[model samples]
Target: MFLVTGATGNVGAEPVRGPDAPVPDGARPVLGGLDDPGTLAGARDAGVRHVVLVSGGSAALADMSDPISRSLTLSERAVRDSGMAWTLLRPRAFMSNAPRWAPRLRAGDTVRVPFPDAPAACVDPRDVAAVAARSLVGRDPRGRVHELTGPHPRDQLAVLAEMLGRDLRCVGLTDGQARAEMERTLPAEYVDAIVRPDVQEVTGRPPRTFRQWAPAHAGAFR
Candidate 1:
C-alpha cells in the first residue's frame, strides 16, 4: 500500500481529489506534522510499502526555526529509516496562493506584493500530486527529493492582471512594507519565502504564469 501524509493540504489535496487521485485505492491518508506520531505509525501498521511526504518551502522551515523543521525532518527520517520506500517532495510557493490576494484583486485592478519583481515559479497542486503518485508507484523514485513548480515565473501584479481580464498594475514592496501589510494577513514566514530561487530549482521547470493559472481560479477573486 502507498501511504500519503499531509493528504488535505495544498499539495496533498490533488491526490485526494484528482481524477486519478491516489487515496481511494488502498492508499491510506495520514495526517501530517510533528504532532501526529500516531498517524505515521498507523500507516506503517497498515502494511504500506511506500510513503510520500509533501513538505512546504524551506522558508516555512526557516521561519519557524528548528521546531517545525525538526518535526518534518524527523518525519522524513522516520519514513526513510523504517525501510519503507520513500519519496520526499518539497514544494515552494503554491500557485493557489493567488486566492490570498482575492480581496485586493476585487478592491482594484492593481495587485501589490513584496518581491513583485523577484520572480517565483510557483507549482500547481495537481502537478505536485502527479509527481507524488509517480514516486509512490514508480521505480527509482525512492530516496529522491522532488522540488516541484509550474511552467513559468511571474509576480503578483502580472497574476492579478490575468485574473481580472485586463491590465492590472503591479506595485512592488520591500520586505518591511510587505511585512507590515501582510503580517496580519498571513504567516510572516510564509510571506517571506515565496520569492526565493529555490522555488524554481526543484520542479526542473519554470512554474506556470499567473496568466495561465488565474482564469480557472478567478472565482476566488471575484
Candidate 2:
C-alpha cells in the first residue's frame, strides 16, 4: 500500500484528498522524524511497499554544508536504503506561502516582508501532490527525482497587491534583515529557483500559476 509521510502537510494533505486521506490498514505510526532512519522500519512492517518523500528545492542545490539540505539528503538516503520503492519530490516554494502576507495586508496597505525583490516559480502544493499520487499509484518514476514547479517565475509581492486590490507597498529587507525574519520560522537556504515541466510530463497538464492560485486563496489575503 502507499504511505505518504507528513500526510497533514501542505503537499501531502492535497494527495490525501483535501482535509485528510484515509490511512491504509495496518499503518503503524513511526515515532522519530525523517532525520531518524530507525523510524522507517515501521513502514515495512506495516505492509507499505512505496514511499513518496516530499523534499524541498534546497535538496536540488546539493549543498551538504546547509543543515536543511543535509537533513533532506540524509532522509533521501534513508528512504533509498530502506529497500522499499521510493520517489523523491523536490518542489519549489509553494503558492500557499503568499498567504503569509495576510496579517500585514489586513493591518494596512503597506507590508514589510523579507525577500521582496526575490521572485519564485512558486508551485501549487496540489500539483506537487498530483505528481506524488501518480508515483504512489503507478510503478513508473521509481527511484527517480521529480523537480516540480509552477508555470513561471513571479514577483510574489506584486501578485498579492493585485489580488488584494490594494496599492500594497513592500519594504524589501536586506540580506541580513531577511535572514533574521526568515530564520524565525525556517532555516535559511537560498537557491536559484526555476520552473520545470515535470508536472506536465507526469500529469499531462500545465502546472497552475500564481495567478490561478492567488484568486482561489484571495480570501486569505483579504
Candidate 3:
C-alpha cells in the first residue's frame, strides 16, 4: 500500500494511480499533518511501505533558523528515518498560486504584490504529482530528493494578462510591506528559484510552463 502525506495540498491533491487501478482504494482517507509525527503511526502499522513527502525548495536554501525551512527539513528527516522507502519532492513554487491574484484582477487590471520582478520558475502541481506517482507505483526512488520546476521562468502577470484578455499591471510592494503581508500566512523567505530537469528526469517529460498552466486555470482568474 502507498501512504501519501499532504494529500490535500496542491501537489499531493493530485491522485496517484497505477496501470490497472488506483492504489490504496479511494474510499479511505487518512487525516494527518507533518506537525505531529504520531499521525503517521497508523499508516506505518497498516503496512504502508512507501511515503511521498512534498517538501519545499526553501528547505535546501536555508538552515534551521527559518521556521518554514526548519519545518520542511524536519519533515524530510522524519520520512527518511521512518524505515519505509521515501521520495522527497521539493518543488520551487506552484503555478496554482496564481489564483491568489484573482480578487485584485477582478477588481481592476492593476495587481499589487511582493516581488513583482522576482524570477520564479514555478512548476505545475500536476507535474510534481506525476513524478511522485512514478516514484510511488512505478519505480523506487528511495532516499532521493527531486527539485522540480517549470520549463521556463516568465512574468506570471503577463501570462495572466494574456489569458484573461485584459491589460494587467503590477505594482511591486516595498520590502517591509511585502514581508508584513507574507508573514501573515508564512514566514517570508525570498528564493530566486531556477529551472530544474528533475521533473523530466523522473516523469520522462518536460514540466508544464506557466502559459500552459494559465489556460487550464483561466476560469479561476476570470
lDDT values, one for every candidate: 0.61, 0.75, 0.76
- Model 3 scores a C-alpha lDDT of 0.76
- Sort by lDDT, top down from the best: 3, 2, 1
Candidate 1 lands at a TM-score of 0.70
Q: Given candidate 1, what's the lDDT at residue 179?
A: 65
**lDDT by residue for model 1 over 1-222, one digit each (tens)?**
444456667666676666454547566544455235565566667786777777654523444444656666666666667656677777666788778777776787766667666655666776677677666665544677665555445565665665567767767788677667766434433554434333344334454556766677778877
lDDT of 3 at 217: 81
Query: 1-222 in candidate 2: lDDT tens per residue?
Result: 445567667786676555445655576643456556667787676677888888876665556888887788888888888878888888877889877778888898877766667766778988998898888776566888998888765677777777667788888779677767655434233333556888998888899878777777778987
Scored by lDDT, the top model is 3
lDDT of 3 by residue, 85-146 (tens): 77888887788888999999889999887778776788898898898888888774588989
Supply candidate 3's per-residue lDDT for 215: 83
Clashes of each: 10, 0, 0
Candidate 1 Cα errors over 4 Å, as ranges: 19-38, 59-67, 175-209
Q: What is the lDDT of residue 42 in candidate 1?
A: 65
- Alpha carbon lDDT of residue 59, candidate 3? 71
Who wins the TM-score comparison?
3
